[model samples]
Target chain A: MANEVESTPNSYPMNGGIGCHSYVKNSHIQRALLHAAKDVITEAIVEKVDITNPWFNSSRTLRVADFGCSVGPNTFVVVQNIIEALELLYRSKRHNPEIPEFHVFFNDHVHNDFNTLFRSLPFSHRYFAAGVPGSFHDRLFPKSTLHIIHSSYALHWLSQVPTQLADRNSPAWNKGRIHGLGASSKEVREAFSAQFSKDLQAFLNARALELVGGGLMLLLVSGLPNEFHSSQTNSAIVLDLLGSCLIDMAKMGIISEDNVDSFNLSIYRTCPGELEAFIEKNGHFKIEKMEELINPVRWDPPDFQMLASHLRATFEGALEEHFGNEIMDELFERFTNKIGENSHIIYDQQYIKETEIFVSLKHRVTDYEV
Target chain B: MANEVESTPNSYPMNGGIGCHSYVKNSHIQRALLHAAKDVITEAIVEKVDITNPWFNSSRTLRVADFGCSVGPNTFVVVQNIIEALELLYRSKRHNPEIPEFHVFFNDHVHNDFNTLFRSLPFSHRYFAAGVPGSFHDRLFPKSTLHIIHSSYALHWLSQVPTQLADRNSPAWNKGRIHGLGASSKEVREAFSAQFSKDLQAFLNARALELVGGGLMLLLVSGLPNEFHSSQTNSAIVLDLLGSCLIDMAKMGIISEDNVDSFNLSIYRTCPGELEAFIEKNGHFKIEKMEELINPVRWDPPDFQMLASHLRATFEGALEEHFGNEIMDELFERFTNKIGENSHIIYDQQYIKETEIFVSLKHRVTDYEV
Candidate 1:
């Protein structure tokens, strides 16, 4: 039974130190990121006119889904904040009283730590909390049932590794490096961006079918600002440093070059323009607000072990899936040392940290199909 | 898909209005009932002063489970009340920053409409809401993981109807009537009592393994009081009236008489002495509080249809399973007429309305086994 707990598909959860990425999710960062967009998200929710008739009571339930709502601490904060805002909107007489019944659906991959997520729920909320286990990239809800959708730091994840990146013979195979590490590979970059566009379209189309007309959605994801390149970004630095450490391991025959080629982080950071174009193409969601915000990483002298854990927690699932669990401790130790060396060298430099995009959308009455 | 929803066994759910007994559960009654025992439950919770030693972190999560937590509205109220009390207890101590988190597991039969139960969960509460689908007759949780358990109107339901009632050749076989309906049959009554004792022992043993030392459990269920005979109880009246109606149907060729004999309700209402004997025999739980409650059903003229629906909702699952769905409407309609006629004949007379037993037990370090 204990073995049942330890041995699950590691494609989504972080390994070691509680065996979950939730430990390193940085709830403070998540809280700060969501709290910043509270007003905008609230505004979208308030503007949602009751397009659903009271006769259609099923849809009348204020259905909200949080895509990629991993195990909590931050999931609660984000959900609570949204619900509170929606409640305030209702109390202000700006929303339908008939829609007071809120049903919140927390969605993630089937392999996500739903047990932990379900076990840590704040059960006294104003609405219903149901765990919908499925990928958000595909439709996880009934048609016209969802009223609002919110996601954070989750959409950057593609539905899968780009097909081109996985093709060993293709120029986009991402040889000897995972995403953003070998930043100059145009084929690799294009494959990630193309996959993101495709996935975002599918995501939008699915939500469009599920969300009633005039429903709302807020998406906060890692992005690349138009002014800055990936090579200069702290996220890319982390990846590059990780890649360098892996290269060092490969030299010692600890990691095979083929394993590196087989592994590519299924994340694609995009600019506001790219997302705007996709939304326009989809035509179901009318973007209310879209902006890029910069979060400067300011840990003086750096905590490499913490950084390694954060990295391990965030991406170890994929790495372990590609490279096997036997190498986890050794890989992370090397990663910690590399980050330690890099942080010391770059400590005085004002590096471009994370760029995040906040997109507020309202589902419009449209004849749209995927 | 809609057929999937409706075609599910409606025997348990009250005849399809909500397809659940939750419609008739009357949250107000539940609230009032639980509120009556607030101080006792509060005292039990507050007395739990281990205050979470860092040495023992696993058990620190104050585990509470509600066995047979049917669909919500009442489930939320009960769970929320308990949590609020626990919070107050913690707050009174000037708050141990480690205010042991509450992880509540809601257990019910697997066929119980868990979707509805989970969907209406009060997610904003202090405790976690997890749906553990299993029969509470057996162990439904990990050993020593639960701190408290609350089960309402659930224990009267035996694991199954007594086997003897269904054995045609056996003298104990109930001929043309359900359990307790043929009041003259001593053999049938003893069989049910035996089954109840056996199931209750199994129930205690299972809960004993799950609950930690010093843990508490509260059970509210339909039972026979010391002064009242089982046959004269209101529940008996409902069952007797239904049985009489079924006999009427059998004569009219609406239902088979054989089906009536085969159909035994899985309920066995016990008196305080019976329960005490069982507890004394299996000394895992020390009875802290035990008493029978009388709810005088004073309807100037009884609403027969309301009574029919109430009965329909409560026993529909097992009834439908024993009989068939074809006779459901005709049977209930006939049941309504009989109850109305019976109520008129008996309304002026002293009628035993409802006898419910409330038992609060404290788990003691006992060297006892079932």
Candidate 2:
């Protein structure tokens, strides 16, 4: 394959196809998050989107995009909700002209299973669908083309693991950890935060260039509260346990400790304050709405198997790439066992306190001089 | 899998991925045709396209689409040629302003392997890339969005097989054959032609809706001369032999005869006269250039194995859907053997006289009365 500008250095496509381990089959929690955010999304569009703009009447089409859309059942649901909400807005305005036709773009990294996504598109969807294969942190569409951009649970994925985390001499060197949380040093944690800030800026800047003036962006990201430590989140706890399982395999001579030391997941949990500050600094978009969504799922006693499957579906590709494909079953088995041993910590109210941030932003027309 | 209006009734996606049997490896002939038409395409754009239109200055972007773009190395080549030619035109015109950015859409059936296509995109190409997943015989884009549309060796694929060919009692009932060529009755051939005409009209009408006024369309199709019979071409000879191979299997009791009777390849080869008539009847596009391309490949003894592989790459999916997967190996083996037996006919000058038609058309601004 030719070197492609669209190919991100660390593209982590969720497991593709409809297999038991695929994202489509294992994204129940994400689906729950989408369902939980539906009303907020609808309300945001109704409140902030300027459907009466002359642009809408003249274009005769509404262009919407879902960024970081993996091979989906959830992304489909997200786009449909957006379209329905837009339709509601059009109806409420009582403008006699026919509702504009919908043209939706499903965007993700080049390696994302667009084939499966395309195949799984809802046949009766009123929208014309196109799959955009590129990193959202880069410009993926022509300027002023997109009207609504939606991304859910995807902003956490940084472009790449921060370079300093793997350097042996750097203060941020994360020698024995797979992420910048749960026993990671303050320097390592700050490195992750800095990377997140940079990634978010790139995302916002690129989107600002692509979106039409007054266009709306609905972002759903998993994050911690301002006062909460990164280590308190359920994801950090599970991932820490996963890292321990990798260590156990190393001790058992099943895999190398060096491989474990070099591998760090490229994900970050941003706080609302940090996100707001970054967006303010960027200044291309106005923060229309930002709220933490309520927890949509409660797993009493925790379904360890289901959790394992979900984690596998989301990270199997990345894990396999780093650790080799042979150790997946044993490694996940050990991770599940470790999760069982530490079930109390996972179920504790303090540990399960991660929040999903729902943000609505409007493209700042004044900021775009052209 | 909800009922999608975008889904064509009889979509035939070429064999995807980069495996031995994939279209990527076997599309040398298509590549040759693309190369053969490059000069003509460049000349047509330079001669016929009005780059000075106010729309180009205001939009600052050009949108081009390649329909029926199978998972490709060839499609990439085609898009590159177009971009380069457009750049040449821009430089020659000395417009002073920076050339408008190119946004290219690679369109094929929803079943096409867009993942592979996206991954194979040129890294340094100066264009934004997108994959539109749906049948070309339907509306795939918003009205007046596309500036240039290209389809090569794809318009021959009908939306579906003619219904009468399988009616058993109809005059067009094509038993013991898989196509309306070579010993098939005139009624069968006429049925195939009618289906092609209908499908072509649908393609034209949809494209007419999507293409901006004064948009250019470059089309390359395999065709026979107006005076020639469908059975006189190289493709027809090979297909007729393939049909005989199926009948041979039926006689050997390896596969049921009824399956063969029910199956007809949903493909038609149009002549220049027929294509011109259809375009004129449609009345949306003005024909700019229509000429037969010079043959780029000459197989001295005819590379039967290569021909077999190429045919397999193109038809394996449709064949598997019609005949059970179990018979694929035996079916192709028999096909190869039959090709060997009829090598003389395939190599004969008269039979190998199939011409590739390259068409350049401009969307008629006056005709599209908005």
Candidate 3:
């Protein structure tokens, strides 16, 4: 069953429940990203959103969706921020006493723990909440229905791993490595880059059809600086270390060498230039604001256990499917020990630079009818 | 946590996951109710739905909601039926080449197992599906947003148990019983009846606000006949037998007597007259169709174990909360034995008369704005 589910391109769900290894417990990094982007999101909504839009006037409801919204606390916090900003816009800016009803959709993969999400919903939320389960690369909502779309720290997940990465005959075959970044071959990096472009195009196209004209889409993405090599990022270093650990396991006969060779992480961090090129090519949405965000929560002394747990929470589903569940404990333990050994790398300012990009896009007014 | 959740009223979620005692595995009776209502639902949509209504043409999307949708194969079945009927209406009757997109919201209490519902969704379903977790007695959608609302075998679950049944000094104190029907005191029955009326009113009032003018609301309810005594129904007799088993356990010191006295089921079966009266008083909806449905599935020679399992699945959550989990296996064992001992009651044709009510209501076109 796990293999069958994994064969499907978009089935990598985060660890469910609130256990120690669950995403709910280990999502501090994503939460910090949300905190960094909150002000930017609020500012964009207040400045760029058209309060006099006819759709809002007619429907008397504002529909918002958070794509790739995993189990909450962070999703809930971001949604609350959006609602508060909109309410302020209605009351303070427009001076409209009648605020439209807020209907928010929290979306993720079919295997996401929506039971946990629903159970942990804020008791006194101002908006009606609904959980939408589907790949966001496909259309999840009806045409011209959503007024706001927000995705935070989730766009990095490509729809699937690049097929070339696993084909032995292909130049892009990422043998003995599980990721395309860091010390991966140039061909492998290009393959991942191409896949990211395709996935982003699909995501943008789908959102274009779903969003109303003048709708705002706010995205907080883990990204790379345009001038810096992908290998220089903190995440790339982490993935490289993880891949080395897997290779070590294979050498020790804990896992098969062939399994290690075939396994590839379906994640891609886009640079600002790549995002701009795609949005321009799509032509349906105009970039309203694009800027690098500074994360407020800095780890002065890195917590290696927490970092290891975080990675485990995010990648356990995919890893378990690739190498089987028996190797999980040992694999993560080795990765943690390796992290401790290489702890000095974290102090290398040049190699450990992390980039978070915040982009606000508006659906262009179009004559196309639903 | 169990006590606090139960105390909030509306937190009785069906046993989650696909275990043998889960609602998903034991929902055959509810599935039968849906099958019996399918034809009536399709016919109502064909005859009464206004295809050329401004709402459908303007939005180019039909929003339908199923209130009290449990984790299901049944909810999926019913939603498919509704969508198929709408497609037929658009294609065959109206001769319209353009059929609106379908967006369905499946709703239950906050505690419903939405994860299971989402994972088991029909893979090739035509509609965009969402799970709305909240009580139907409250407003779940924006005003005038829904074009169709359907609930099957779910309206019987009241928002909460009647408080009067637990008050020792009150005339309605239901001592040594778990339900209001079948030899329960007259005061207890009246209290249940009043609670049902209040809950039904809330359901109707909320739907009236959410549904668009000229929208359709279809309901398939487990009910009693107008002139028949509640104590005579098969379910009432079954409840009586189950209550006897609980009292026997209490006598043997297996459970506290006070716990049994305070444990009244929140379910209420409304007769056709009661439904009509509530609709008449509410006045926002016009009854288009009202009739009793004949269930097609019949248990030949009565499978006592299957019957016991079904009852256990439905009531285990409540029972476990009132009395701890340690007694579950023994409680069900005794209940099954008691059912086997009183198997003669199943053959009493008059007492075994089960009533399934099918109701179709049309939202009255009003000048009220959203």
My TM-score estimates for the predictions, one after another, are 0.52, 0.96, 0.96
Please tell me which model should have the higher lDDT, number 1 or number 2. 2
Superior candidate under TM-score, 1 versus 2: 2
The worst-scoring run of ten residues by lDDT in candidate 2 chain A lies at A1-10
lDDT of 3 by residue, A51-168 (tens): 7677655558899999989998799999999999999888876554798889999999988999889878887788888999988888889888999999998989988888887789
* Runs in model 2 lying further than 4 Å from the true structure: A1-9, A52-57, A298-301, A367-370, B1-9, B182-184, B298-301, B367-370
Q: Give the per-residue lDDT of model 3 (tens digit) for B7-104.
A: 37546888889999999999887787788788999999999987766766565889999988988989999999999999998898565468889999
Which residue pairs in candidate 2 have backbone atoms (N, alpha carbon, C) closer than 3 angstroms, thus clashing? A5-B123, A123-B3, A123-B4, A124-B3, A124-B4
Candidate 3: regions farther than 4 A off? A1-10, A367-370, B1-10, B298-301, B368-370
Give the candidate order by descending DockQ.
Answer: 2, 3, 1
In candidate 2, chain A reaches a TM of 0.96
Query: Which tens-of-lDDT digit does each residue in A14-84 have in candidate 1?
Result: 33223534452533445566656666666666665343433123333466788887766667777877777
- Quote the positional error of residue B107 for candidate 2 in Å: 0.8
CA RMSD for every model?
21.9, 2.3, 2.7
Q: Chain A TM-score per model, please list them.
A: 0.87, 0.96, 0.95
